[model samples]
Target: MTETVEPFTWHVAQDAIDDLHRRIDATRWPERETVDDWSQGVPLDALRDFVDHWRNHYDWRSTEAWINAQGLSTTTIDGVDIRFLHVRSAHENARPLLLTHGWPGSILEFRAAIPRLVDPEAHGGTAADAFHVVIPSLPGYGLSGKPTRHGWKVEKIAQAWGVLMARLGYAKWYAQGGDWGAAVTTQIGRQNVAGCAGIHLNMPIARPLPEDLAAPGPDELKALAALQHYQEWDAGYSKQQQTRPQTIGYSLVDSPVGLAGWIYEKMWAWTDNQGRAEDALSRDSMCDNLMLYWLTAAGASSARLYWESFASFAPAEITMPVGASVFPKEILPAPRKWAERHYTKLVHWGVLDKGGHFAAWEQPEVFVNELRKTFAAMD
Candidate 1:
């Protein structure tokens, strides 16, 4: 691990932006989907419209500016250069909080919630709820350096996080995440790493063990049915990413439309949108996330994490204080009873009325309040 942490800034070259537009303009699109709905994937009409806006009206520089407005830094940990945004609250005794983003998402997901978290008083809360926020671009995603070797699974990532917080001189900290982040945070809790105060997850991955399944109740059965539904209808992306990331990587890295459609489908399918994904998330926000994957060429490398650990990324029993905010439309909303089985010391649990897999992005105010309420008792 290198002790030096360097300040970082994002500046996409003009030529690169021009090239991206040219590619979008010249894309060889496929025929429209057979169905009227999003069953076959991102509808050709929707993707074409999105690409047109991306080519003509979307402003990448504004997104870049937004990211640069936050405090950015990079450090080498476990042989990879990790980029992160570290924002400290003005309030003394502010708690240290580390946030992790999942696949098909980036640190951009938390952009709206950062100010509220770091300076709660300014966002209609007390200094007592302030947090020193740190949001890292996951390895092989966004501005973070892609791993050259093959061993960058969730466990290694969790360990690297421990090292990261320590390097920042934090003696104790809370961790929070959704999706892959949830997996990493869960691992951190299970490891009981020194200085890790507790963990909170928006997507709690607590499944019924074989025994629990033998005589399950309605909630457990509902959770199981949801999991089954995911495996059946919603897991094709995971299957491909886990089995043939490089195959899909070729298209994702080579074609911006391919990358956009790939991610756009998830935004549509996974969000709490009634019919269209844009109902819950704006085109700019969706495009911002797509740009992270496109600019970094992280399509394959990021997907490789699934190949590396999907089967093995099962939830472990954790005794550390745990908090969960269950979004109703999450990929799989584990029942509180099921979560209690895995999170033995579950200190907080909130069943959100709305929101989905991308809770922070979909409902920033709600997400922030959940974090504040979840961790308040910890203090």
Candidate 2:
């Protein structure tokens, strides 16, 4: 698959930031009853505080400059344009590692850890562990162009990544991902393409009970009980995305505040936010992510993925060397036996003491260690 390299530039135009400022200042707020908690949606009070900061103090140009400071490149894979940040090691013998980002996250999440992963020496590690890193914006997210057709399933995305790595002349490489990224990376492992040596996942999807493990041990039963409880209360967002994404996406596509609330709610509910999202993640990082969605107008495109593949992606077996770093507040955690039912060659599985769905962003050291151990063992 021949790929067309594009002129990739990271300097976001000044007009774009001006436009965001105008939108933030011109917001028409709605009144809400004092009694209504966050259950209804984004709290009016929180949006106001965010909007005030965004309008008065936020610096989009600086953010753009910082992103530009990191190396970036663009390429067209199977007709869809993809933008990525490429960080290569000084060691010519470095291994290639393709890192995938999930929903509401861009290549931005990995910015802090890229140098550490690629060079390692500055971070007090050996160059022997160096990796040539490729962090792409998932289709319909950030810089990647939205898919025009309906076939942008995880399988297709995984294949596209295969083409991507091969285009870069990597015949064998390792992979890592979280959230929907884990889904795509896991599919790559299943496909067992020539380049994908092994995979490490932070957010492994819940495996359905195998007949042997269906009869719950006390611990398994507790895990299952906890999962069931979450589904009842917290799974509504998944149902909405999988069914009527466009309807909800309309508001999110237009309003940055709306989009922030929609995504931030999940970040708060899913992560160890300690009841305040700002305590865990800064408003700037949060806004940077929301801005990526707004600038690209990817709300509908992002949600359509759920509607497209949710129905067809059945729980099935995967036959590849795999590792999972199970964070405490992740959507699900499978015991070794249960995980083996799906990941037949489950070589590494660890119970993380901290973090949640956004493990890499929150607990990069823990995530990095697990990833290093898993891939190193396979090598």
Candidate 3:
């Protein structure tokens, strides 16, 4: 495995763009949902409006330039290509932080937060809060190479991150993530990655303890209720991905509208929005994120991560310093008490007033502040 981080840029062909518009134009849309609310799914009208914006008003060039300006590079690790944004801060003593993204998310999730992290003085923070940030698209997501074999689980990705940071010449660093990235960061702490000082997570990997299940307290009851809701109402996508990723991959890869609705539904479900996902995340950002999937044909390759690691949350007690922020609307915002069962050196615990699943993407200011405070306290 030659460790070479080659600089990369987006040069999407005109034919691909034309095909995307063609597909969007030719979409055979479904009728309105039976319910007024999103009980049935992303309503037909909402999806049509989203696709309209994506087809007409959204500027992929702006997003492409923004991303390419920050600098992107790829390196082969574990027989796969890892695509990442490597932005070194102007501050020489800035700490190195490895950020990761998860499903229904791309490297786009971290775009707003990256500048603030790398140049803290401009964004309500001192030089001390500055960081050299490295944000990688998860294996099989975004531009990263999809795994050709069966063993690319969260732990595998975690080990690869360790290798990546070391290769980038960071002797000591910190990590943070939510969703699958959280799962990988948890593995980094659990595996005790070399020179990793500490880690933070928005969605901690914790389940209801036997005792908590038997006798529910306030936090325990909250965990239980979220669990029940997920099992009953929110887990259809997971079950489908877990059981048959290849089947749905056809729809996702073939139809731009199919791909948009698949992710658009999750956007509505996960964000702290007022009836529409645009209330929390801007239309341009959402469309930018959608383009990554549409262009890469990543529907099944990305979904396969669920097939690999969904059943095994891989709960284990980690001795490294850990910090967490529980947003109000995280699908399963694990309480501190439940988290204590897995993180032995729980250094910082923050329960935020607002925000939801996509912490960095949804509430970047709050997210960057948490990282600063948590890593500062870890030392």
Candidate 4:
């Protein structure tokens, strides 16, 4: 089936920008948290400072220009329009690579890594390290069209990715992802889709079996403890998004501050920062990510993904060649043995001393190096 591919240019209406500012300016103040730290959530003082910066200084047009500079295109696949960035490398033997992003993230997450991956020679890498990259906006997340019906789960998204790679004339390709993206890429491996050479994940989701737990090693025990800590402390957003996304969607769409606070807290909790999210991500970068959600009015639509496929994306075995980079600050850091249970042909495993959930966004150089090394081994 031939699909119509159209060039995409991003432009936010002036009125929408004005309205966002008005909302930010008119935001009602909530009482300060009872505690001094961020245990309750984003601290009132920190949020206020961030909101002031966002409203007063953030530049959306510059961000739009940055996006426009990429090879942006959209195509209708399986009755849904998908948006993606297709950047081909100048290197003759460049491998096609599909990169995916997860919740609270968009195609922008991979912006910095794109050029380095696509034109490695220009970035101190050999031509052999080059990759023709395809970074897609997950359905209903960024510029991609939202689903009007049900059944748009990760499995379906994985199938769509296969179709996407095929549509782009990639008969054989590699894949990489983190967060919800890890789930999608893992499904692609599990399904053993044609043309999928292998996969690399920054966040590999693997659970210890009952028997494995019986005789856990030090790393496995630490992993299990981290998983438990995450479920107890950091999973409220997941539950809300999975069960009642629509309820919070109203607030997210109507209030820019509300959306920022929702995502900003995760930045603090998930990133390798020193008590502040800004320490890891610049104010402009955070605003750029927030604008993808704010401009698209994707608050409810994006959250619906959790409702559609969170539980279904639990850890499962994948037989194909696999690589993983376990960042120290990830919500749940799976040990090598634990991941090996699922990734039978685990080829490359790197335990980095730094970085977090948003690997590419937080540490692009380290992230790029990991991908290069991981794929070189598998290649």
Best by lDDT: 4
Q: Which pairs of residues have clashing backbones in candidate 4?
A: none
Task: State how far residue 145 of model 1 sits from its true place (Å).
Answer: 0.5
* Cα lDDT of model 1 by residue, 69-134, tens digit: 788999999789999999998875899999999999999999899999988978889988899999
User: Between 1 and 2, whose lDDT is larger?
Assistant: 1
For 177-222, candidate 3 gives per-residue lDDT tens digits of: 8999898999999899898999999999887767777888887787
Clashing pairs in 3: none
lDDT of 3: 0.90
Models, CA RMSD each? 1.3, 2.2, 1.1, 1.2
Model 3 ranges with Cα > 4 A deviation = none
- Which 10 successive residues of model 2 have the least lDDT summed? 205-214
The list of candidate 1 runs beyond 4 A from truth reads 210-215
Count clashing pairs, candidate 4.
0
Candidate 4 positional error at 150, Å: 0.8
Arranged by lDDT, best first: 4, 3, 1, 2
Q: Work out how many backbone clashes candidate 2 has.
A: 0
For residue 242, give model 2's deviation from the true position in Å: 1.7
**Model 4 lDDT tens row, 1-379:** 2496778988889999999998888989899999999889999999999999899988899989888778889998888889999999987589899999998988999989998999887888999899999999999987999999989999999999999998888899999999999999999999997899899999998877888789998888888888898899999999999999999899988889899999999989999999899888998998999999999999999999999999876787788889999998898788888788788888899999999999999989899999998888887
Output the worst ten-in-a-row residue range by lDDT, candidate 4: 1-10
